[model samples]
Target: MPLRPSRDVFITCAVTGAGDTTSRSDKVPVTPHEIADAAVEAARAGAAIAHIHVRDPKTGRPSRDLELYREVVEKIRASGVDVVLNLTAGAGGDLVLGSPEAPLPPDPAGTDMAGAGERLAHVAALLPEICTLDCGTMNFGEGDYVMTNTPAMLKAMAARIRELGVRPEIEIFDTGHLVLAKWLKDQGLIADPVMVQLCMGIPWGAPDDLGSLLAMTANLPDDWTFSAFSIGRNQLPYAGLALAAGGNIRVGLEDNIWLKKGVLASNGDLVERAVAIAEAMGSRVMTPGEVREKLKLERRW
Candidate 1:
């Protein structure tokens, strides 16, 4: 007989991401209060985990302002909402390439690179149980730029994250990114049972297809833990797919803004949707404490 998850599976709700996507919808949280409240709502809807990225409230744009991140983390910890904290170390690496005619100088508005320590300063102090380490650079959508994470830069960042005792969830956008993640592990830059998030169907990167998902899934070593998600419409489908692959599910407004074709979705709506899907598959929706035990995670105290 085929085995199933006897215990509940954990659900992570990405409350907000660094994407400049607020203009597309008004539901995206902006201020610290809004972000914390959204996270609390997601947790209540069965999200054991809340992945976060803060923005400049005034501009609704991605911000690495440690104080903004600090306030957001502080409010969430004090809000009495039991949820795992997963910060984003990816706030400062948006690199928009320059025109081909003059490739020497990066477009002033496009490239914003920071030292690995500076990039991770928010995590160093907030010390969330988990933070994302983008595994490799790729062409994000049909944009003129490609996300960049050189091996040297990633190694340095990984070393610093290990020093801080913060677990890194490798976000792999393509199969090659998984290769780099494995290399980082082999080099001892990252710890054992490394976590990977297989991101799919974002324009120029890996497509949201069964074959692509299987290829990336097959690339993972037996000891590694992995998750998969498709942007927009595929988010829920990939949730089922990830579970079948013995992985977890991530959903929220960060990747998809609508519950249905025409409806706007709140963070809680997305979490509840994922929970329903997981439960329908004979998997329990894990609570924050359950996730703590599963991931060996420390509560954000």
Candidate 2:
């Protein structure tokens, strides 16, 4: 496909992901207060949206606790920052199996599978302007762990998110995930003005090459709004790549811990770098209000 490029782009700062990154970087937010502060800082740094994931305050491990989410949302709202909130509804589907010789029984400590209601409990309660819907199940990273999101689960979650009036950002890790996204749309589970997030450069999934990224974007429906990101070092470069591919950008410590070769980055630092990249490409970084208008989001404090 040709390089259409996005003239008007929006940046989504993924504040803290459900990854084991805290050990590597001290900038990763753990408590709700810290996470909320990081999100607000990112918004102030020119991010239109804040894609958030909560962690256990004590252990620094990812948590889906309703109260943690509640505190984070309340803090962000009370901060009076005008940034779109996009929560992660992609948790509770972690499936970690045993050894290859004994794969029947899954590892309890690493596996965390839940029903549709439980998986989307935080989203339904908070009703953020946007929540992610991971479109497919895949082997995530170097482990026996598989990110498990069955078809039935995705359909049910999509229906619920639509009913809640919160837009579901279809997260695609591979080209096949786009197939499931279309299937959800065909089943009427997903609504119009669809938004997608192209996740690249993960093991056993799509590579972070330009050709692969172009292929993924080419398969997307023309009417759908989209953003793209790759993990670690490529995260910053993908900001420009996303704009060149005619999609928005996503960045933060969640996807990348380093701002430069040996520098640990805060969420604000990442957002600042992304803004610079977008502006240098002659693309306008959109504001939160503009994004809400474009996506037709419903904001509730």
Candidate 3:
């Protein structure tokens, strides 16, 4: 049977992703207040969830500060937005290696590693409905840098998230990531009703092509919740594709800035547009409460 269409789909606004996008667009929120406001605005624009990453208020670069994340969560709650808080647990470890000759110490200019416990400190306190856990490590790009996350590190983080009663949005950048993710499930490191985010088109990782997407999708457990997104220009377009593929969509400046060439967008603008796109396709956008039920998530208790 064709998968029945639901009245509404779920929208996750990746409010303030920890990328270098701030350098390109002034509209990207910097301070915690600004980030929280962006999230609230996304909620008002019909986003059911806010996938978040914090930054140093001064530089707007990504930061793993627990205090900053706390403020964002508290402000959103105080404002009474029904958005599900999906705090990021992908920070703390970024290892940049030196030339092939010297690999032991890593290049100081490119390395940003952290203790596993410290890496997930924010999620521990906030206990958001969802948090991201990158499943595998990869040579990030041509640069002398790498986004390092070993199997041991992933298991450690997943264990903690499970203990804290937080849902881990397994982020798989490639087919191998899915391999490790499934293994994690088999090992009972994560619970059933598994959730994953198929990260496509990330440089030096997964290409944003249909084959790559299908390969990852094929490996997902027969029954699991999933969402998908691409960076830069493909962000919104892929949202529709993800929905059509029997998955959810993720959008926001964390992945893209311009609504079009030469036009910068606010988080709300992009979210409102996603609602229109999804609805136009005869698909319904789910609310946060609806997502809670669909994922069997326990709300703040």
The numbered model that scores best in TM-score is 2
Tens digits of per-residue lDDT for model 2 on 129-148?
99999999999777699999
Candidate 2 error regions (>4 Å): none
lDDT of 1 by residue, 1-301 (tens): 1333434578888887867668887898988889989999999999988999888899887788999989988998998879889898886677787767766577767677898999999999889999999988887756567688899889999999989888899998888888899899989989865778888888778998988887777777877777778888889888898887777899988899888999889999888889888988988887889777766777758
Candidates sorted by TM-score, descending order?
A: 2, 1, 3
Off by over 4 Å in 3: 1-8
Q: Residue 205 in model 1: shift from native, Å?
A: 1.5
List lDDT for all candidates, in order. Answer: 0.84, 0.94, 0.85
Q: Candidate 1 has which clashing residue pairs, if any?
A: none
Q: Name the 10 consecutive residues with the lowest summed lDDT in model 2.
A: 140-149
Assess the local accuracy of residue 70 in candidate 3 as a C-alpha lDDT between 0 and 100.
Answer: 94
Extract clashing residue pairs from model 2: none
Q: Model 2 — TM-score against the truth?
A: 0.99
